[model samples]
Target: MPNKNTHYKVKNLHGTSKDRYSKKKCECDNWLAHWRNNTKSQRTTCAVLECARKATVGAHVICVDGRMSNEWYIVPFCKYHNHYEKKDEYFLDSRVHLIPVYKLDGCKRG
Candidate 1:
């Protein structure tokens, strides 16, 4: 959980610039800095309705057995859009999500 102070700092930054670390993406663009550079491991874009560009990894996509829940879930969001979107979704550090759930451990993603 983020404290009020942290939230204030982020808000201040985001209010001024589109930097997620600086906290101003809604004003600029949703993708964060250093994203194209992090592609060596696991990195990708937002899984929302019609978003473009690459989002940063926030969680490892996971799903527990037989439960319509995000128990083992993850949230795929850039530092910017993560704070903005998710109509009906969950994600993880890898920053990816697919509806109706997929076998994350069952499949491999970059």
Candidate 2:
């Protein structure tokens, strides 16, 4: 749940390269499932601050603050927001939890 004081700064990764990871399998089946299993929360609306649409995909994003620029994180997103261009940046709601898309050892397992 959001703490109301911890907004996450994120940017969509390049769509073309992001698609390449679509077929990879994790213990939870898909990225969305991975997010759910890891966060211990149910998917509701898109993670974007004001988006009201139901979340349908686990969109890949990278932190824009440079600390984790090389790592990808997954957050729930609607079909529309999931297609944002790489240059698009947004502040995710404080309640939204980011799940690491990959592990240093291997793909993240549930």
Candidate 3:
């Protein structure tokens, strides 16, 4: 768990990959499931700070601070907030767990 005062800067990377990784699969079936499994917790609200909407999808985002920029992370997001048009960077709640998309990052169940 993260401290309540902490926040992580992240940028939505949806639609940026041209669907290249759309077919990629993890042991948990979907990115949202992967996130839930890895985090060991369930979220009812969006991960974006100040957003109280219900979370409906696992959004792909990248850390904007250059920490593991090449890696993609999964965060819970509402349908409206998950769209590509909302490209502005936002701060995620510190308690939200970022699940890695890659299987080798320990998202695999074996």
Name the 10 consecutive residues with the lowest summed lDDT in model 2: 101-110
Please provide, for model 1 over 14-39, each residue's C-alpha lDDT reduced to its tens digit, 9 standing for 90 to 100: 13233333332123122222222223
The candidate with the higher TM-score, 2 or 3, is 3
- Model 3, 17-90: lDDT tens per residue? 35677556667667677778778777889999889999987888988765555688888988888887888888
Among the numbered candidates, top lDDT falls to 3
Question: Which candidate should be chosen as best, given TM-score against the real structure?
Answer: 3
Model 1 segments more than 4 A misplaced: 1-43, 59-67, 70-72, 84-110
lDDT, each prediction: 0.33, 0.74, 0.77
lDDT tens readout by residue for model 2, 1-110: 53224678888765623557775556666777778777878858999988999998888888775545467888988888887553677889878877887642334545
How would you order the candidates by lDDT, starting with the best?
A: 3, 2, 1
What's the lDDT of the predicted structure labeled candidate 2? 0.74
Off by over 4 Å in 3: 1-5, 16-19, 104-110
Q: Which residues of candidate 2, in runs, are more than 4 Å off?
A: 1-5, 16-20, 23-25, 67-69, 84-86, 103-110
